[model samples]
Target: MKSLIVVDCQYDFIDGTLACENAENAVNSIIKYINSNDIKVHYSKDWHSIHNGSFKDNGGVWPVHCVQGERGARLHEDFYKHVEKDVKRPKEDNVFYKGIDDEVEEYSAYNAENSQKLSLKDALEDEVIVAGIASEYCVRETVLELLEAGHMVEILKDGLGYVDSEDHLKNLQDLMERGVRII
Candidate 1:
């Protein structure tokens, strides 16, 4: 079965505190692609707690963002609208949340679980088309995890962003070397 793994395209990753470079530009294309596809769509949220080491100020690597119930944690409005409208099918229960733990950080959506405790690896059958913010971060981590789980992952190149250009290219190279296909 085909699945579209949409990583954190939330406000915090796009235009909020931890915004990625050019992340905003991918919105329309992502929306069009999701609405036009017939396969299952998986949306991942970086639902965090109020305090965590994931924030630089707290001694973690990243800035503070995506706290649960916060505005920054919400998905980009337009992209989320597509999820709300399209993820209603009985077989379409793929919206998962990650990065919620205050102690250990989980960048991959596969690390998160649905209400039923199903991870993406459990929910997905075969192939996945990836799209989301920060190509060098959450999106990259999720794709690597999916690939390790034996899923065929094809990243939508134009639909991703990165905080650092050089690291972005390096990460893409790493994915390609690991048999991930870029579209």
Candidate 2:
């Protein structure tokens, strides 16, 4: 069965730290698609520590966001309200937490540079339809990893959005050429 992996579709990415206009606009449509499909859903979250690179105390581009137990760390308020109770766990739907360590800057749902593998990879165990924010960064990284692991991949065009449209488009094209489907 197809699994829908929502990669960092959090408030931090949609309307928080890395919020892009396109990403915010894509949220509802993505949610609708997930609800309508009735397929299993997975979400990856950037549960960063206080000293994460994206914080003011560190050298990073983004402002602090998605810190554990913070408002910015929470899911998009509207999306959360819409899909809260519906989210399954330990299998059908689970939140893969990343960026837990202070030094590692995790850009994908899979794993940080030195962390253990994401449970999402094994749980899905099949092709995954992925959608979420910052296409140029996390989305690109995750897609490549998924491909390398031998899974059929598809990106929901209207569901995933980008900060750098041009660069992200170029990367998407590269991924397409490498067999990641865009629909």
> For model 2, where is the 10-residue window of minimal lDDT?
84-93
Q: State the lDDT at 177 in candidate 1.
A: 95
Residue-level lDDT of model 1, residues 22-130, one tens digit each, is 7877666677777677777777888888788788878898888998889999878886455445463223256687876788988888777766767767777599988
TM-score of 1: 0.90
Model 1's alpha-carbon lDDT is 0.80
Listed in order, each prediction's TM-score against the native is 0.90, 0.86
**lDDT for residue 7 in candidate 2, whole number 0-100:** 74
* CA-lDDT, candidates in order: 0.80, 0.75
RMSD of each: 2.4, 3.3
